[model samples]
Every structure is written in structure tokens, then in C-alpha cells.
Target: MYIRDVTKVDIETVARISVEGWRHAYRGIIDDAVLDGRSVGEAARQWQEWLEDLVRRGDRLAVADDAGQVVGFASYGANRDQDNGFDAELYAIYVDPDRLGRGIGTALVRDMGRWLEAHGYEDVVVWCLKANPWCRFYGRSGARPVAQRIIEIGSRKLEEIGYGWHTMATLREE
Candidate 1:
């Protein structure tokens, strides 16, 4: 497996993986309609916007690939939440459902954290659905739940748990 920077050529693959990841990760936690009702076009548009934003801000976007196939992806930058109270934020981390447990997600996150630290960020934060298994992955990466908030996405409302790694040094300790 190889980790590399994301490019426009990888946008569609990222979108597909993101949709699959959401479907698997949000199962039982969110309404089936919301998950199944999501359109690839919508996801692609979101991916395009995200890529544009990353390019504009000069943030890091990394993908884990196996033989040129993207298995996982992550994005990190300065905290976007006005009240996140952290210097850096992991905007999204998603692995293809079929690629779970392969350590791709872990590597993607570690790379993002290191990128943030190298850019002078002292703290990093990530938010996941409170019931999502990915929360445990974040915990294993030395992130502690620091806050919680109710987020409304489409017609579904989710309780999101915010996890924070106060410093890159602490992440290495995990």
C-alpha cells in the first residue's frame, strides 16, 4: 500500500468510497432513507468543493492506495469550527467499506496528523457520530472526546462526538 496526495483524478474514487463509508458507518445510527437516498452526484459535488477548498487553503489531503486503487482518504487543516477550540482539525476520514480493518484508515490519520504538526498546528480535532466505530479508531490514535454537539444533516439529526489530540507528541504515544 502507498500513501499519496489527492488529485482531481482521484475525486470520483474518493466520492464512491465516501458514500460506501457513510452507508456502513451510519447504519442503524441514521435513517436508512437518508443513507440510501444519498446520490453520487451530490457526493461528487461535495468532493469537488472539498478539493477546491483544500487547494485554496494549501491543506493536506492524503489517500491510501493499494495498487493504484484508493482504499481510504483523509483531509486536515486549520480548525473550521468557530468554537472547536483547537488549532487544527481533521475534516474527514473515510475508508472504503470493503477495505475496513486493513489499517488504511490508521495510516491516513497518522499522515494527516503529522502534516498538521509540520504546519505548526499544536492541537488537532476530529468529529464523528457518537455511535460510529470510527470513534474507537480515533481513541486508539490518542484522541479524547472533548465535546459533543447535535448536528443536522439533511433530515437526520446526529449527536457528534468531538475528539482532540492536544499535540502531535501525544499522537505518537498512541
Candidate 2:
């Protein structure tokens, strides 16, 4: 698989991956009703607007492509929490559920880390739903549990755990 910045051509594919990833990964963790109405076309339009905004803010979105198709993606930018003390945050990272364990997610993250480092960001944070098993992936990626919060999503109060990395430089080691 090859990793690079997200492009206009990858919008729909990435959005579809986002929807599918959430559906598959959050099946038992998140409220089913929240994921029920998601569709690729609608997600694509939403992601298009988000991507444009990210671009305007100098954020980075990277995609993992296998055989010219988007298999995974990661987006990162300045930390959202005012007191997090982190320079950057991994806003999102998801690989097609079918492609899990093939290193696509890892590669996308490494790319995002490198991009963050190049932009002079040393520390980064990633938050995942506490009920989601995918949080283990962050542990394996060298992030440590640092914080937690409850976020309301469509009437559901979900607990989120924050993982932090001291530096992006180490993401290049492995």
C-alpha cells in the first residue's frame, strides 16, 4: 500500500471507508441508531466540506491506497483541547474493516506523525471511545492513556479516552 495526502478523487472512497469503519468497529460500542442512517453519498458531501476546511486551516489528511483504491485514512491538526498541552492531535484514523490488521492504519498514522513533526509539532493526542476495542491499536502505537471525557452524540453519552504520545519522532522508529 502507498500513503499520501488525500486528494479530491479520494473523497468518496474515504468517506465510505469512514462510514463502513464506524459501522463495523462501533457495532456494539455506539448506539446503533447513530450509525443507521449513514450513507456514502451523504458522508462524501460532508467530508468534502470538512476536507476543504481542513485544508484552509493547514491541517493534514493522509490516505492509504492499495492498487489505486483508498483503504484507510488519518487526519491530524492542532490539539482541540485548550489545556491538553499537546501540539497536535489525531482527529481521526480508520481503515476499511475488511482490511484491518494489514498495516494500512499503522502506515497512515506514521505518515500523519511525520507530517506533524515536519510542521514542528512534538506531542500528539488521539481520543477513542472507551467501549471501542480499537483503542488497543493506540496503545500498540506507543500512546499512553492520559485523559477521559464524556461526549454526547445524538442523545447518547459516550465515554472517550485520550491517548498521548510524547513525540512524533518515535513514530519513525518502527
Candidate 3:
């Protein structure tokens, strides 16, 4: 697999990964009606627009491409939260369900740190649904559980936990 900055050509695959990945990740945790109600086409369009904005703003969106096919992605930028004391925030990371457990997610996270480090960001933060088993991935990568909050989605209140790395050095492979 190869990692690179996202381009227009990757929009569709990224969207598909986002929609399907979210469905897979949130399956049992979120209300079925709400999760199942998501529209792939809509999600694609929104992702396309979001990608454009990220590119325009000089933020980073990296994809894990396997032989020309995008199988995963990670987006990061300046922290959006107030007084979070983090230089950068990992807004999202998703791999195609079929591609999970192949080290693609780990590679993406490491690449994200390299990209952020190049941009002068030392500390990184990420938020994941508290119920997501994948949340443990961050911990395994050496991020510390730093905070938590409740977010509402389609009439359901879900808890999210924040994981933080005081420095990206920990993400480097031995």
C-alpha cells in the first residue's frame, strides 16, 4: 500500500470508505434507524466538499492506496477545540472493512504523525466513539485518554473519548 495526499481522483473511493466504514464501525453502537438512514451519495458529495476545503486550507488528508485503489484515509489539522492544548487533531480515520487488520490503519496513523510533524505540529489529539472497539487502536499507539464528551446523533446521545499524544515521536515505529 502507498500513502499520499488526497486528490480529486480519490474523492469517490474516500467517500465510499467513509460511508461503509462508518456503517461498519457504528453498526451495533448507534441506532439502526439512524445509521441505516445514511445516504452514500450524500456522504460522497459532502466528503468531496470537505476534501476541497481541507486542500484549500492546507490541511492534510492522506489515503492508503492499494495498487491504485484507495482502501483507507486519515484527515488531520489544527485543533478545532478550545484550549485543547493540542497542536493538531486527527479528525477522522477509516479503512475499508475488508482492509481492516492489515496494518493499514496503523500505517495511516504513523503517516499522519509524519505529515503533522512536517507541518510543525508536535502534539496530536483524536476523538473516537467510546463504544468503538477501534478506539483501543489509539491507546495501542501510545495516545493517552485525555478527555470525554457527549455528542448527539439523530436523537441518540453518544459518548466520545479523546486520546492525545503529547508528541508524535511515540508513533514512530521501532
Question: Candidate 2 lDDT, tens digit per residue, 59-110?
Answer: 9889998888889999999888869778899999999989999888778878
- Which residue pairs collide in model 3, if any? none
Q: Looking at candidate 3, what is the lDDT of residue 44?
A: 81
TM-score of 2: 0.96
The window of 10 residues in a row where model 2 has the poorest summed lDDT is 165-174
All candidates' TM-scores? 0.93, 0.96, 0.96
Candidate 2 has an lDDT of 0.89
lDDT of 1 by residue, 34-88 (tens): 8898777789899999889888998878899899898889988888886868988
User: Ten-residue segment with the worst summed lDDT in candidate 3?
Assistant: 34-43
**What ranking emerges by lDDT with the best candidate at the front?**
3, 2, 1
- lDDT for each candidate structure: 0.85, 0.89, 0.89
RMSD of 3: 1.0
